[model samples]
Target: MQKEEFIAIASKVSEGLATDQQKQLFLYHLGTFAKENPEWEKLDLGFRQQIEDEIKSDIRIQVFGEAKWKPKTTRLWPRIVAIAAAVAFIILGVYFFNYRNDKHLDIDNLVMQGVGPGKNGATLTLADGKKILLSDAVKGQLANEAGVSISKTEDGQVVYKVVGVRANEAGKNNTMTTARGEQWVLELPDGTRVWLNSASSLTYPAFFAKTGSRKVELTGEAYFAVAKDKLHQFIVKTKGQDVEVLGTHFNINAYPEEESVKTTLFEGRVKVSPFYTQGEALSEGEKATVLKPGEQSVLANNTIKVLPANTEQALAWKNGYFMFENENIKSIMREVSRWYDVDVIYQGNVEQKTIEGTVSKFKNVSTVLEMLESTKVVKFKINGKQIVVMPGKDNN
Candidate 1:
């Protein structure tokens, strides 16, 4: 294909107006022409110049001050979007693959820009403690455990469909566990929807039958959209406390490594048991505190600390982005460690700085870490599976 033909195809691809046949032809031409002439890879110079002009003027700027990056309270998409938009036209309609071919980007290449995010896979433990790997299970009815029909979908979700005869009969309990760098969604027998994050596990009855109330034990973080069962209260039990609600949308962060367990309510009301009195978290015989929508209850120091919740931040993992706001390097690294399945080792005092940005969780580990390094607050050295974080020049 000629340069003019390639430009026309790129315009259509960028605008998302190409037909299925047109898209195929465009891709075929790209493979052939791009291989023969490297200069014609991205849009010709004429088209790129136009995009560059549009980007510089309208793109929102999020500034990083000094070697020690300053605190930021800025939006994410408006910043790098112009550049991403420009590249979308050139790179086969990839949405957020913000890549650059530069000598300074050697680390990026080592990390392999194609290293994408984790997907759904988990271990399902039956009442008999039989651990079944869901990834190995076929896409269909997995089993009929305790009269509940368990099935796996192509989209990577486990669904429990309650049978008619045993609708009120209690089935054996089951547990779903996702290790580091894994995630899985579950649709409980009670119709509740759960999005489980990495390094988390949940245990519940196979059937909600004949129970006084619905209860589940959680050992990690999860977002719940409870199905409204007015007669049956939904209670989530953690090491710290129990979150009881009728029907609500909420997120719970109860990782054992963290200092406290946080329950952020997005809709309806929830009662956090063993309510706090003050700064303490692990006190005995605490009372229950009711939290309204948009409030978060932090179980720490033997008390329930209530604060306003950022709903978007709580749901970022499920939405496929790493959203940070006034978060320190150590806290952010902990999350990266789980999602990327890498061990984090700190060097010097790297937690002195804060980061505020949004990047694609689906990107390679290098891209995600590079986003932080861009702020100049921290530097990372990849040593096999372990990442050592060091302080930036200003902090030194």
Candidate 2:
């Protein structure tokens, strides 16, 4: 296709004025244009920006479906910067094969009015077994345990500030847990920041020992930005594995119900190793896998496998998004179940399918369900706090 023709088609699609046939043809020719015309600078400035916006809109439509597609005006950056963003989106693989213009559901009154998304809330259990409902606790200092002063910020973050330096405080541990439909963020005494997802728990000592590693036990999923401490290593222990790093940013999905424990590294480096059972020693020559940035280590059946990772997808929950990249329906439902605090029931034979897209976690459950329904690979019925999953109408 000629440059002018491609730009015209992109403009039409962006304006929702393109015919189905036009859209299909434009999508087919997209790769050709990108490869042949590597110098996007050759185009007029306005046209370059138009194609960039069109690419982004295409990604959003693939993520949220056309029903939620809205034209957004953005200032163009340097040619290099803007072109890189567009190419990154293309490389990520935006699939528009399931675009349906008539998939918006008329949500039932009950669903439309209720079943909202998760919020910042958690339960804080002290070493003495005192449980403080963080959501109910007023902002500010909630408790003083060991040498740390635990407080809830106005923005709903739980923070621990060291108030005393005493050797006796080393063993005092505290646990922060988020139930279904709730997520929470906290600052550890050592300045590590943790974003805990729904149905997750993080346990750490109120005071870090001067000699050993700063260790924490995790359940479910969490994203961590560990403070750089060259003298002390940071370690996260899960069901069957341990993630060790001097300091790094990473995420761990270790829900007991999940088939594998996944540790995704976003920055710096980490070593993932098998968790030794009681009385079991680390076998000689059994080294941990060193995971670099943008890599993930999957621990299943007592072994760790390393692979490339989609960092955005791994940290989507922490970023207030449900970004699925051809994920299994059952796995997607598991996340929905947690964030919406709903039970899922499969009625009859449900077709196995994978889902792709991105949706805001802050929207009502109905919005997410409707977007997923547009894929024509699945359908849902709301029954009180339960969701009944059935095969999509197209599959009938």
- Predicted structure with the largest lDDT when compared to the true one: 2
The regions of model 1 sitting more than 4 angstroms off are 1-115, 167-169, 275-286
What are the per-residue Cα lDDT tens digits for candidate 2 across 1-396? 676676666546544566656655556566567656433332223335555565566543532456543333422212222333233222222212233344444333325457887877899999999999999999899998766799998667888888877463355889999999998889998899998999999999987887778999999999999999998899999988888999889999999989999999989999998865667555532347898998998888777878999775786576555777877678889999999899999876655666667665666788777767777767788878889988776545
Worst 10 residues of 2 by lDDT: 88-97
Instruction: Report the lDDT tens digits of candidate 1 across residue range 56-110.
Output: 3332121221123123233333223322333323232222222122123222233
> Over the full model, what C-alpha lDDT does candidate 1 score relative to the true structure?
0.70
Report how far off residue 170 is in candidate 2 (Å). 2.1
Residue 217 Cα positional deviation in candidate 2, in Å, after optimal superposition: 0.2
- Model 2 steric clash pairs: none
- The C-alpha TM-scores of every prediction are 0.70, 0.72
Query: How does each model score on lDDT?
Result: 0.70, 0.73
All predictions: root-mean-square deviation over Cα? 12.0, 11.3
